[model samples]
Target: MPFTQAFINESFRFKTLLPLNLMRSSVENSSILGNFIPKNTRVLANIWAVHNDPKVWLNPQIFNPNRFLTDDGKEVIKIDALIPFSTGKEILKTIPLVKQFK
Candidate 1:
């Protein structure tokens, strides 16, 4: 059943397919969290680190598929931290292919 899909999602989160997202070059000079990013600088988001951050997820290292389920266990909760495909402009590009597998 689809219930097992939650486990799949959790598995992906536990061990991300791509530990680091694709490198993106900054189009313009920018400052993020007080850190300066000059134009053309290559930046990559650590997908594994974000998935394992305690601040964003409780017991992140533990395998807990229940975290993605609703209180009544009827639906999957939309969590902002569960971004294995990345949350940038390329996010939507992966949806169609991902949904086909499900």
Candidate 2:
């Protein structure tokens, strides 16, 4: 069962159905990872970039469902970089509904 969940997450991360999540905007001036941003700047989280980043993931391009499984292989590891639905209040609200449907 855990491996099943891991496989699903890995598939979602690798496939990246949307490629890019909904665009986001800065509510006020902000700085991110040494990058500065003015208020109301439109920003998009490149789903593909984050999912495929070598720094965040090992062999990101390779389809490896085992990556999400723990060494014991009994539990699925939660990967922060895997954000197929993006993240925020809206997504948090929708998650339960999605789970129910799924």
Candidate 3:
């Protein structure tokens, strides 16, 4: 399933609020603020680097939509891996309508 769908399913299954509360909790609990990301971190998030890491992805530089596609041809996107907002002090106020996966 797509990350958003999975999040929704899990949230529904657990009976939790959407978007804000979860995001807040994740930020609060993240190690990015401490060790993973440097202190005084002003570097623009290397989203490209994260998305294209050969160690994490099968084809680092290739634009393979199949990388995100599921066995059923629906796109199986991972949310945590593709956070457009990146980790920062600013919070995302809007929740996007994410594509669904089987």
Candidate with top TM-score is 2
Q: Kindly report which residue stretches of model 3 are placed more than 4 angstroms away from their true locations once superposed.
A: 1-43, 89-102
**Per-model lDDT:** 0.71, 0.73, 0.39
Q: Which regions in candidate 1 have their CA more than 4 angstroms from the true location? A: 90-102
* lDDT per residue as tens, model 2, 1-102: 998999999998899887776887878887654467799998665667667778677999899999999999999998767777665635423332223222
RMSD of each: 8.0, 8.3, 12.8
Pairs with backbone N, CA or C atoms under 3 Å apart (clashes), candidate 2 = none
Q: Which residue segments of model 2 deviate by more than 4 Å?
A: 89-102
lDDT of 3 by residue, 1-57 (tens): 464554443233233222222122333422432345334433343444444446555
Model 3 shows how many backbone clashes? Answer: 0
Q: For candidate 1, give the lDDT.
A: 0.71
Cα displacement (angstroms), candidate 3, residue 86, comes to 4.4
Candidate 1, residues 1-102, lDDT tens digits: the string is: 335877878988899888887887878887654567699997777778778878677899899988888877788876666776765855424432223222
Query: How accurate locally is residue 13 in candidate 2, as Cα lDDT from 0 to 100?
Result: 85
Of 1 and 3, the candidate ahead on lDDT is 1
Evaluate residue 18 in candidate 3 and report its C-alpha lDDT on the 0 to 100 scale: 27
Candidate with maximal lDDT: 2
Each model's TM-score?
0.77, 0.81, 0.40
The Cα error of candidate 3 at residue 82, in Å, is 1.8
Worst 10 residues of 2 by lDDT: 93-102
Task: Answer with 2 or 3, whichever has the higher lDDT.
Answer: 2
Residue 36 CA displacement from its true place in model 2, Å: 1.8
